[model samples]
Target: MLPPTQTEAFDELPLVERARSGDDSAFTDLVTRYERKIFRLAKHITQNEEDAEDVLQETFLKAYSHLGEFQGNSKFYTWIVRIAVNESLMKLRKRKTDRTVSLDESIDTGEETVVREIAVWEDSPEDRYSQEELRGILEKAIDSLRPAFRTVFVLRDVEELSTEETAVALDLSVPAVKSRLLRARLQLREKLTRFFRRKGDDVFAYL
Candidate 1:
């Protein structure tokens, strides 16, 4: 099934009706509409391009199988996001369950990429060279966040979802979402501070 056009109207009703009737093309249209956003959410949560792609494919497949159960109580996009978030969390939990890493060690590993990327974003870029450098740095920094914290921050901050919306998407309580977001921000702040301190020292020495 080909994906539908990027129409701004609420096409969910029609799509849902079609999908409910087992129209494969309608389902395909739905996938086309959301594939990019789903992939991005997966990438941000997983910090791995390969894992993100896998999650995207798995999410849509699962969503397809469960189409009959969809209640249409919410927007289709929101419903899709709920599924994607659950899929990412499931993958993350599975990974953690398979390993036993110390929290301190994990924090150290996460800080390197997060801090480096934060530093890159601050550099004033007057040329293409500088812009490209900044992009690479930011990507690395985003990839450095711990899987759990990274997902929370990306959903709440990067995606600009409301607290309620994030909670719904993650199947988390409002308080849980708030606490996770706070921790993510604190972690990012610490990483960014260290980066700036190093830059400040370099500038002072240069002066």
Candidate 2:
């Protein structure tokens, strides 16, 4: 994975060094800091709690084993995230359930790529939806994405990883990450546009 900004690198240097030097507590501390985020990322990709848990455990196991190869060039978090992402994808591969779009393949964004004006959902919709209901609707939209697109979206947008970080995590080029992210956003916008209108949400926004 790509190294984080200098500030993030500096912040993590001590713990990484300690962990690399066989400090068990330091390794534990690293896990403590990032386990939840990794689990969430795994779950988002696997779409199964059991698979996510397995991925989470395996991610750390691999990380601990490979600590010596870490090279102190990247943020420990970024490295672990790459491991977690790879493990999650491996789980999907084993299941043989998901059809992944190829990052190297060029697919048209439709005949005409006109930007659509999407209506944004407000705090309270006219239909009086509960928060859980709203969240479920969004989740459904996200779940509709292909595995490749979904991974890019989760890493770059949900996890708030930089484009560079996401590119490295997925072993993709920066332009590939950007292209896939755009496709993912456009797909989500299209999927969610109808929901907002159906719920009588107000205010238009670009997605």
Candidate 3:
């Protein structure tokens, strides 16, 4: 069934109640409302199309089974995001691989204040590459981030969730979310700067 557009308002509380009462259609409606966004978040975390799809299915299934336990402390969306994040992390653990970039790593800057050095784009790469190509480049850079930083980056920057929302979803404090996001951005900038430099394009300058 087609989901209503964002502009089309519906009372989610009623739908939630209906679904809790075994109204299958109501549950389907709720799925329609959130599936696309949840899939995107899963994809960002899993970094594989197939794994993302699996995560999407697993997330909804778990949510359905645990619906009775939900206490309404946070938005339903935030609750489901927490599930997706956990499922994604489980997948990572099963793979027995480590993918992380350190936040404490510092780069030399002329200023007294310590900070990570990131390359500044001279002319936004938007001017040099097609949108599709730039998107591919950006995706690669994001994928290279350590999972901790990547999750925070995806939630706070790409998904545009608020710091509070991100913190709730990841079960972290707001300050932790902010710290991870800052490190994620710095790592991405450094990566893209190196990429453009390696391509011999004067697109970015290292600061």
lDDT of each: 0.69, 0.81, 0.75
Q: Which stretches in model 2 have alpha-carbon errors above 4 Å?
A: 1-10, 97-117, 120-131, 195-207
Q: How well does model 2 score by local distance difference test? A: 0.81
Q: Which residue pairs show backbone clashes in model 1?
A: 3-29, 113-141
Tens-digit lDDT track of model 2 for 82-118 = 9999999888777775455344445446432356756
Among the numbered candidates, top TM-score falls to 2
- State how far residue 127 of model 1 sits from its true place (Å): 8.0
Backbone Cα, N, C clashes tallied per candidate: 2, 0, 0
Poorest stretch of ten by lDDT in candidate 2: 198-207
Q: Which consecutive 10 residues in model 3 have the weakest lDDT in total?
A: 104-113
Residue 90 local lDDT, model 1: 65
What tens-digit string does per-residue lDDT give for candidate 1 at 56-157? Answer: 999898889888888888777777777888777666656666553222123333333343333333353323346676566555666677665676678777
Report the Cα lDDT for candidate 3.
0.75
lDDT tens digits by residue: candidate 3, 70-151: 7776667778888998888777666655443232333223232234543445565555778888888888888888677888
Q: CA lDDT of 67 in candidate 1?
A: 84
